[model samples]
Target chain A: MIKLNSNLMIHQYFCLMIRYLKKQNFWFVFTPYFWLVLFFFIPLALIFKISISVSEWGMPPYRDLFSLSEEGFKIDSTLSNYLFIFSDPFYIRSYLNSLSLAFTSTILCLVIGYPIAFYVAKSHANIRIILLVLLIIPFWTSFLLRVYAWKVLLQGSGIINSILIHLGFITEPISMLHNHYAVILGVVYTYLPFMILPLYGYLVKFDLNLIDAANDLGAKPVNTFLKVILPLSLPGIIAGSMLVFIPVVGEFVIPEMLGGSDKLYFGKIIWDEFFVNRDWPVASALAMSGIVILVFPIVIFQLMYAKYNFKNE
Target chain B: MQNTILRMNKLFFKIFTLTIGFSFLYFPILTLIAYSFNDNKRVMVWKGFSFRWYKELFQNEQILEAFYTSIKIASLSATFATIMGVMIGFSLTRISKIPARPFFIFLSSSPLVMPEIILGLSLLLFFISSNHIIGFPSSKGQLTVLISHITFSVAFVAVIIQSRLSSYDKNIEEAAQDLGTIPNMIFWKITAPVILPSIISGWLLAFTLSLDDLVVASFTTGPGANTLPIVVFSKVRLGLSPEVNALSAIIMLIVVLAAISVYFINRSHIKK
Candidate 1:
């Protein structure tokens, strides 16, 4: 509607460029993508690159990914690291131990956390927030301290032993601290919040009138929970279980503090390989295989779930 | 009469179950605080009630220095992570034209579930390679740790921010544009104010995560950049110390206060 001249065209073009640069949408997409690709994705790629490299005793402790030898062009790579990992009984046992530990701890968490989450969700509106705050406060506290709390409780001369002795439960203190069970105890204690929070997220939104109607229709309490509550909260159960299971498989600190030599885990193996053995190739291979063993299944499940939901929709 | 008795029994059962569950949750916390008051050098042995460990904790330089380092790193990392996280969050929810959206989403969210040990090792290796090739970050210290912390915590902050943005009403921004407000003005004025609570919460969450991290920090830390968790873990791994108990009590109190304040603030915002 206004004037259109040569000068106006130049001015409008400059303004368009300026506006494009200043757009929030442009900044939002560019900034995070750049940083994430640079730091996270590239590093993972580097881990992959080094994992395939040959193990050597040197300053970075691994041979180069590619080298110009007597041959014109050479890509010096080996699958031997992965082969060694698969061949070693210690490595195989550790992986199996981690899976078993993760499975046991996840089941324990669900068993313990379900009731707590349900109770809090069923509480009066005013009291629910207070209880949730109480739950969150513990989670926000030092994780190391929380794990140490178990150490204090399970030590041979610790509170559990003292209480048991006092209560005439047992005369001699049972060795509780440095064992596989202690590791399970520590994982469950520390990760209980992770399970409960997500479960509560799903449960709190649930319509209670369904339960009332089920009961009115002659369904017992157990039957009502089985039919009405459990199916509706299945998604939360899966989400919470995955959250706990995945991390515990790769857990290092809990075992180090609480577990004895009775069991070893994938995480501790990677740690030992890196620092204790100074084997970068083996450590990277372990991590890569961990990504394969743990994450691949989760990704597959997620993709299948999304596709199934899409098809149904 | 029978129905009333049945109701009473049900009520008692629920209450009993809740009591047992909550007790299990609180038992360890209570014992930790109680032992902090124990006077003996031996943490389990109760010589008498005294403030010796608390007094010693105050004078301990190593603990205090690590505490200082943790706070500094956390604050810095949280601020940087929040900025990057807000961008990721806004892009995912508010914009639709992003390139490689799926890959971006994967990168941002995968860290939330990735094992800390793997992440730490990868970052350390990356840094070493980076130093070897480029002449930057020649050594691992607070800076390297900060970079690693920000990289991981950004995912958490982005998650918090993403949820907030997705649930937000877009009509307000549309209405602002109807009044002839520019896009930039509308975003800065309207969107920023609406998402301010999320931004603050994201920052706080990032801070907590950075401070609490041990496994990752341990992998990335150099000789001079020991974090609180790393220091505490080293001490606790060897044996129990009452001074650590005292220190833990203090940390719990501070965390509790911060959580309460956040709860009240969030509640008030929801009410509004």
Candidate 2:
């Protein structure tokens, strides 16, 4: 009888705590919720609004969506901005350029980063921490400076050309500064750490004994990697790829710093459309299109993945 | 004999990969640091080593002021972001009855995947429209930049704090509650100490994000609020600047020292 009373007391306390927490949740939720709704969500909605508005020659540079003119409450909205983006091959080509750039850079980062992450994860315990710190140092440094480092190294009269000439690899100084290849190099170099860190996070926790288990079971080295290691590291690979791929799609600084007029990117196009052309409607349209193309699919994929995991669990 | 040869090959591969990786990572930085001491006006040309640019960097008012502005914005934004992020994280993980929870999650996490260019453009437009509508923030300046930084950084810190809070033990808080402790006291006494490391790291992460920003800062900034990156970028946009090289060396040195100290602190914590 005493034990039952104590159990009842504990249950009552638990209920009290839950009720208190549920009531206080509103206060905890209110500040950030209000801030995000005002700052982030509304801004995104504003972009959508401006995207549909008609471009006009004025201060705000676009006609209000709903005007109080003599046309009896007519909506001054058009899909023409989006149509303009789609109709021009220049805009379409820039989107393609960004996609291909992201794909290529992500692949290159993976190929390069995999070995580094693998080796670092496989290192002795004493060395792994130091290696991880070294990896993070570059990540924490100024990104512009890292890109600038490439600029300095690839100059016409720079060390790379000098070295190539001295080694008789080329007779004259080759132009390495402003090109697609230079942009790719810059992207891969800067994003390598992002790829390596996630891959390391997964690879470090991985069981090495599995390799030995496969080896003892007559599995060849390549087979062991393909069947065992690769399968297990898929989560890490996906995480790292997402980290590198998404940002590279909208990358502006690297390409601007390193690229030439030969290739224009989606980011650069959006920048020019807003800053250079002063086409607010068209810029908003491009950004909205980008969100539709890039963000929507990821959101759907994540939701479906969550549902799938829920079913399994 | 075969096993010995295989082990040797494995060791060789490990060494080869690490060397290539570290060199790829460090070569440019080391080169930049080495060049900072060059006496020539041109950065790359060989000359006797001197502290010429470092001396010049000290005298340059624009870069110095920009640096000060960047530091002020970064620290302030980091603090605010950390506080709001902790609230969001705590709400998400501890309190289960948040209304429109999915929308809340989307608002917090979407910024992580949003492109910096798009984010910058959207925030700039927001500031412009709001200013026009309210006639407040009569001009763009550091305040606009601070708001933008805090907006994006709250997402990052929320992720860090949420992960930490979820991974830690919940029994301590429950125990405190069962002992007749009040909710607020229980949080401060039990939960805060547990997640303190994550909060510190979150602040540091937000600080770096604000400091290193150029695209967003560019879109949001007006006259008199040029951050360090803005100054460095303008100086180097056409060509190289030796004084910027000195600045990079200083920044890199500070970063490396901070990283090493954090590592040591973590090690000591673990030992304890």
What C-alpha lDDT, on a 0 to 100 scale, does residue B258 get in candidate 2? 95
Best by lDDT, which number? 2
Please identify model 1 stretches exceeding 4 Å from their true place. Answer: A1-25, A300-313
Candidate 2 local Cα displacement, residue A159, angstroms: 1.3
Residue by residue across A82-165, what tens digits does model 2's lDDT show? 999999999999999998999999999999999999999988888999999999999999999999999999998888999999
Q: Which regions in candidate 2 have their CA more than 4 angstroms from the true location?
A: A1-22, A300-313
- Please report, in order, the local distance difference test score of every candidate based on alpha carbons: 0.87, 0.89
Residue pairs of candidate 1 with colliding backbone atoms:
none
Q: After superposition, how far is residue B35 of candidate 2 from its true place, in Å?
A: 0.7
- At residue B183, candidate 2 shows an lDDT of 94
